[model samples]
Target: MIRLAILGSTGSIGESALEVVRRHPDRFRVTALSANRRIAALAAQVREFSPAVAVIADDGVGGVPDSGGATHWARGRSALVELAGRDDVDVVVNALVGAAGLGPTLLALETGKRLALANKESLVAGGSLVLAAARRGGGELIPVDSEHSAILQCMRGSGARDVARLILTASGGPFRGWSREELWDVQPSQALRHPTWDMGSKITIDSATLANKALEVIEGHFLFGIEYERIEAVVHPQSIVHSFVEFVDGSLLAQVGDPNMELPILYALTYPGRAEDGALRTFDPVASSPLTFEKVDHGAFPLYGLGTGAGARGGLAPAAFNAANEVAVEAFLGEKIRFPEMAEVVARALETAPATEPGGVKEVFEADREARRVAREVSEQLQREGSSRKG
Candidate 1:
C-alpha cells in the first residue's frame, strides 16, 4: 500500500483525496494529515484516517483530540515540513493553498518522496527550485490539477521533440462574456458560483478573473518544459475537455472527462498503474453536450496577460505575480476592493516590485514578501482613491 501524507486536509482537494483513499482502502493508507486553521475538521479527519501524524497551523490551540492517544500531533509550519519529509511517507500530497505549500513541496522532493502536487503556487513561486530539488532527490513530481494531469496523460507515448504545442482549456468562468463595466461590481458570491467544477472560494475567484489560467500556464512551462509562446489557453464552456496537446504532425490529442477532482487525485496516487474503479465517471460522447472553444479576451481579463507575462520574464517575476495575486484575492474577498481592482493590484505590484534571481527558497520567500507588501500598498491606495471619488 502507498503511504500518503495529505497536506491541507481540510480543503477541497484534500477532502477529495481523502475520499479516494476511502474508496481504495486496500491500495493506499493515510499516514499524515495537515490543516491551516480548521482544527475541528482536522480532528475529524484524524479520527477517520488515524494517521501517524496530524499538524495544525494554529498555535495555542489543541489540534485534533488524540482519540485513544494513538495519533501523533504537531503544530506550525515547521511541523508541516517535518511531516512531509518523514521517511515512512511514500507519497506526499501537497494540497495546501497559496505559498504555504511551497516549503513542504521542497521538503517532500528533497526526501525523495513522490509529490502529488495540487498547489500551483508552489511552481508559480519557485519552479526552478522545486524542479532542481526533484532532480537532486530523485523523486517523482506528479501534477494533481486536472489540466496538467490531462496533458500528462496525452503526452504519454510522445517524445518532447515530437510535441508541437499544448492547449489548456478554461471554463471561461461565470464572467466569461462579461464586459469590464459589467464585472466592475461583481460580488464574491457571484464569482464563487463556478459552473464547471466544485472548487474552493479562492480558486473560484481566480477562475472568474482568469488568473487561475495564468498560473496554470506558468505551471505547464515547468511541468512539461514547454515554451510560453507554444502554450495556449482557450475558453471551453462545456468543461468536458480538461486539456489538449497538438503534435508536430498536426494531430491533436485530448483528455476528456467529467470535471471531477477525484479523477486527477486518483490518477496521481496510482500513476503508471490503472485501477478498474467504478466510482470514476465514464465519458459518453453522445450524452455530453457539444464542445466549443474561443479565443481568450485579454481585454476582459487582464490578469491573464499580467501573470503570463511575469512568468515569461522568469526569475522572481512569477513569484511576485503569485504573491501579489494572493493578497489581491484576499482583499477582494474581504470586500476591501472592487472585483476588478484585484487585477489592478496585481498589475501595480508587478510594475513596482523588483525582479530578482531566486537562488533558493529563502530568496523566493523574500520576493514573495516584497510583492505582497507592494500589492497591499497598491490596494490601500486604490481604496483611498475610491473613497475620495465617492466623497
Candidate 2:
C-alpha cells in the first residue's frame, strides 16, 4: 500500500482525498492525518482510518479527544511538519489553505516522500525552496490542482522543453463578467457561492477575485518549469477543460473532466498509472456541451494581473503577493473591507515590498511576514478612508 500522511484532513481537498482512499483501499493507506483546528472532524476521520498519528496544528485551540484506537496524538504546528517527514508515510498530501503549508511541503520533500500538493501557497510563497528540497532529497512532487494535473496528463511522457505554452482554465467564479464598478458592492456571502467548485472559504474568495488563477499560474511555473509569459489563464465557465498544453509543433492537447476534485486527487496519488474509480468517471462532452473560453478581464479582477505580474518579477515578489492576498482575503471575509478594496490592499502591499531573492526559507517567511503586516495596515487605512468618504 502507498502509505500517506494527509495534512489538513478536515478540509475540502483533504476530505476528498479520504474519499479516494475509501474508494481504493488496496492502493492507499492513511498513516497520519492533521488539521489546524476542528478536533471533532479529525476525531471522526481517525475513527474511520485508524491512522497511527493525528495532529492538531493549532494545538492550543481545540480540545483533544479519546483516540479510542492505536492513534497517537501530536500537538502544535511543528507536528504538521514532523508528520510529513515520517519514514512510514510514503506520500504527503499538503491540502492546507495558506502559506502555513510551506513548512510541511518543504519537510515532506526533504524527507524523500512523494508530495501530492493541493496547497498553492506552498509554491506561490516558496517555489524555489520547494524545488531545491525535492532535488536534495530526491522526492517526487505531484500537483493536486486540477489545472496542473491536467497539464501533467497532457504531456504524455514529453519533457517541458517540448511544450510551447500552457493555457489554464478558470470557472470565472461567481463574478464572471462583473465590471470593476460592479465588484465594489460584492459581499463575502455572494463570493463564497462559487459557481463551479466547492472549496474552503479562503480559496473560494480567491476564485471570486481571480487571484486563485494567478496563484495557479505561478504554481504551474514551478511545477512544470514553464516561464510566466508562456503560462496563461482563460475564463471557462464550464470548468470541464482543466488546462491545455501547446507543443513546439503547435499540437494543443487538453485534459477534460467534469468539475470534480476527486479525479485530479486520485491522479496525483497514482501518477503514470491509472486507477479505476467509477465515482470519478464523470466526463461526458455531450452533456457538458458548449465548451467556451474568454480572456481574463484584468480590469474587473485586478488581483489576477497583480499576482501574475509578481510572478513575472521573480524573486520574493510572488511570496509577498501570496501573503498580502491571504491577509486581504481574510479581511474581506471578516467584513473589514469591500471586495474591490482587497485588490487595493494587495496593490499597496506589493508596491511597498522590497525586491529581493530569498536565500532560503527564512527569507521567504520574512517576506511573507512583512507582506501580511503591510496588508493589514493597508486594509485599516482603506477602512478609515471609506468612513471619511461617507461622513
Candidate 3:
C-alpha cells in the first residue's frame, strides 16, 4: 500500500483524495494530513483518516488529539513541510492552494517522494525551484489537476518528439459570454457559481475571471517541459474533454471522462498501478453532447494575457502573477474591489515587479512577497480613488 501524506486534507481536492482512499483501503494508507485552518474540518478528517500526524496552520488548533491513537499536532507551514518530508510518507499530495503549498511541495520533492501536485500556484509561483528539487532528488512529480492528468494520459502512446502541441481546455466559466460592462458589475455570488466543477473559493473566482486558465498555461509549460507558445488554451464549455494533445503525425488524442476529481486522485495514489475502485467511468458521447471550443477573448478577460506572459517570461514573472492574483482574489471576495479590478491589480503589479531567474526557494519566496506587497499597494490605491470619487 502507498503511504500517503495529504497536505491540504480540509480542502476540496484533499477531501476528494481522502474519499478515494476511503473507497480502496487496501491500496492506500493516509499517514499524514495538513490544513491551514478550519479546525473542525481538520479534526473531523483526523478522526476519519486516523493519520499518524495532523497539522494546522493556526496555533489555536493545537493540543487536541481526541483520536484514540497517538497523533502529532503540528502547526504552521513549517510543520506542513516536516510532515511532507517524513520517512513514513511514500507519496505527498500537494493540494493546498496558493503560495502556502510551495514549501510542502519542496519538502516532498527533496525527500524523493512522489508528488501528486494539485496546487497550480506552487508551479506558477515556484516551478523552477520545485522542478530543480525533483531533478536533484530523483523524485517523480505527477500532475493531479484534471486537465493536466488528461494530457498525461494522451501523451502515453507517443515520444516527446512525436508530440506537437498540448491544448488545455477551459470551461469559459460563468462569465464566459458576459460583456465588459456586464463583467464590471459581477458580484462574488455570480462569480462563485461555476458551471462545471466544484472547487475552493479562490479557484472558483479564478475560473470565472479566466485567471485559472492563465495559471494552467503557466503550469503546463513547467510540468510538460513545453514552451508557452506550444501550449494552447481553448474555451471548451462542455468540459467533458478535459484536454488534448496534438502529435507530429497530425493525430489529436483527447482524454474524455465524466468530469470527476476522483479519477485524478486515484491515479495520483496508485500511479503506475490502476486501482480497482471503479470510480473512473468512461465518457459517454451520447449523453454528453456538443463539445464546443472557441478562442479566448483577450479583451474581455485580461488575466489571460497576464498569465500567459508569466509562463512565457519564466522566472519571477509567474511567481509575481500568482502572488498578485491571490491577493486580488482575496480582495475581490472580501468585496474590497469589483470583479474587473482583479485583473487590474495583477496587471499593475506585474508591470512594477521585475522578473528574476529563480535561484532557489528563497528567491521565489522573495518574489512572491514583493508581488503581494505591490498588489496590496495597488489595490489600496484603487480603493482610495473610489472613496475620493464618492466624497
Please report the candidate that would top TM-score against the real structure. 2
lDDT of 2 by residue, 1-391 (tens): 9999999999999999999999999999999999888999999899899999999999678578755558999889887889999989999999998999999999988988999999999999998889999999988999999999999999988998999999999999999988988988888899999998999999999999999999999999999999988999999999999999999998999999888999989999999899998887767879889999999999999999999999998889999999999999999998889999999989988996666778999999889999999999999988888889889
**Residue 172 in model 3: lDDT:** 95
Q: Score every model by TM-score.
A: 0.97, 0.98, 0.97
TM-score of candidate 1 to 2 decimals:
0.97
When 1 and 2 are scored with TM-score, the better candidate is: 2
Clashing residue pairs in candidate 2 (N, C-alpha, C atoms within 3 angstroms): none
Error of 3 at 128 (Å): 1.6
Best-first order by lDDT = 2, 1, 3
Give the whole-model CA lDDT for all candidates, comma-separated: 0.91, 0.93, 0.87
Model 1 per-residue lDDT tens digits across residues 140-219: 89999999999999999876677899999999999999899999889998999999889988899999999999999999
State which candidate has the highest lDDT: 2
* Candidate 3: tens digits of C-alpha lDDT, residues 1-391: 8899998888999999988888888878999998887888888888787889988876665555554575777677677779878999999998898988888888888889999999989988888888898988877889999999988888875666788999999999998888888897788999999999999999999999899999998888888888877889999998898999999889999989887898987887776667676556667889899778999988889998888987788779999999999999998998888889988999988986657687787888888898899899988888888778769
Cα RMSD for candidates in order: 1.3, 1.0, 1.5
The candidate 2 region of ten consecutive residues with least summed lDDT is 60-69
Clashing pairs in 1: none
**Backbone collision count in every prediction?**
0, 0, 0
Residue 255, candidate 1: C-alpha displacement in angstroms: 0.3
Candidate 3 regions exceeding 4 Å error are: 60-68
